[model samples]
Target: MNEDKNRIVSHGAFVVRYRAAGAYRFEAHSHPYLTVTSVMSGMLEAEIGSSHLVAAPEESLFTNSFQSHSGNGSDLEFVSVGITAEAVAEAAINAGFTKAGADIAFNNSYSSDRSVAEIARAIAAEVLSEEPGRNAMLDALISQLVIVLLRSHLRVKRSPLIELSRAGPVDRRLRRAMEFMHDNYSRDLGIEEIAQAAYLSEYHFARLFRRVTGVTPHAYLANLRLEQARELLINTGESISDIAGAVGYQSQSHFTKAFKAVTGLTPKSYREGTTRAVEPAEAGKAGLESSNKVSSGE
Candidate 1:
């Protein structure tokens, strides 16, 4: 099946596009750049190697350069964005990494990632809607998708943090609240208080906060709290419960869960001078390199 020509939107750095609905299958083809794809509906069967990875609704896939992959599904509605090899290499340089980092691969073919899938949906929606600012919207969403892909799927260094202009009028409103969050994360703070800090209503504050920071206020606050808690853990001799309370968590268990989510260690493990546990580099361990047989799939 051919893709909808109207669905393709390209900026020099990236491309946001989607396939038209019909019987869909690929008899093993490969591209020269990175292709990140998402299946909005229908099941996609991907043969990565000896295993067949299935991508269902809201699941995305990553294919590395020159990796042969094929898919089979009926009436599959999906969106994909490709980062050109030159663009990927340039992003690596911008992030202070070697050019080779841009050619990274995914350990798993299908990812049930909310952020990646949502970006794809948003790009597709903007494409189909013929929105007034379609190019800008698509560029923003596609850029975010690239960041998520590099961090989560490729496990590269997260060097290029958000760097939008705080001088913008809308962004100026959030600067004070951002500072407030940084200073007061260890208090019993909520969105209402943060919005009050910015003199914005909660809904408006939430929308603008995410628009500026690429995360919700609550998430940003939680990250700040966790970072502070880690500093205290490493530098001080405070008890776990004291640290939890100081970090604004009402209960130690909740704080522990949040800490582990970010650091991969419980408070006790962290404070006792234990190194963070490493996720088994299963794919790398298995010598899952690009080859004639092992193909990274999308």
Candidate 2:
């Protein structure tokens, strides 16, 4: 097996475990691998890009690769199932799934109370168990999990590509601009360069892009950079200055200021917060609250 495959706890394309003590905080980060998270026990507040999601016990969150996000848990134990984007796309094509054109952004709420939760629990248990044919078992479980999630997505009439296409002409153009920004975010991206990618005049593109995405192209790019920096901070022991440079910020102070503005917490504080545990009382309360959130939404 390849080293990347070996790194996985499962036989499928992507899967791993993150077990941390107390309330865990993750700085903004993006992964090349798609991720599906299941909260075994605990409460977590996650920000996927600019949107916020609250995860309770048995709930799941699916994020596409390179989707900027961050999370923090107070008194919780969780397991995240990582699937490669290539694997998901291949599976969809093989299954002949069509785009549904709805934005199926990940919700903190459970998709289905009985069935989806049951499947999540079963997969979690099997993954944690040491038994015969564990690899095969994991592969089967991942397949089942993907099916359940696809069903949930279909029920909501949401397909990623379809949703992207539905963003209207202006939004589509903005998405293209975002693509360009992502590709060259570490380098100096002139407004004219981004505008050309979307086939619009710089003034027109700048106005429309902000109208659609709620931030100037520069601000949006900065947000993406900070998100990348946050990920390195949490996942690696890289020094702050190195991370700053990697994400295109020459001044550590500038990066720190932007990171705090977007995340509401300084990077150092966020990292330290991850080391503290969530109080038992608060965990119980969050569990109850999440249950209510799911049922009420239905």
Top-scoring candidate (TM-score): 2
Residue-wise C-alpha lDDT for candidate 2, range 130-224, written one tens digit per residue: 45544445556767776666666423234434323221212344667777777777887889999998899999998987665545777667766
Tell me which residue pairs clash in candidate 2: 14-82, 22-277, 23-277, 75-278
For model 1 the TM-score comes to: 0.47
- Candidate 1: what lDDT? 0.61
Q: What is the lDDT of residue 221 in candidate 2?
A: 75
| Candidate 1 per-residue lDDT over residues 1-298, each given as its tens digit | 4342224443334545566555566544444347878888777777643357888889988875445566677667787776765555455556665533222455666689998889888877875653354444555676677677766776443323322232111135576787787678788888999999889999999998776554577766766677567656655678999999998999999998877654334677656622211123322222111110100111
Model 1: runs farther than 4 Å from truth? 1-6, 49-51, 96-103, 155-298
Q: What C-alpha lDDT values do all the predictions have?
A: 0.61, 0.57
- Whole-model alpha-carbon lDDT for candidate 2: 0.57
Lowest summed lDDT over 10 consecutive residues: which window, candidate 1?
A: 287-296
TM-score of 2: 0.55
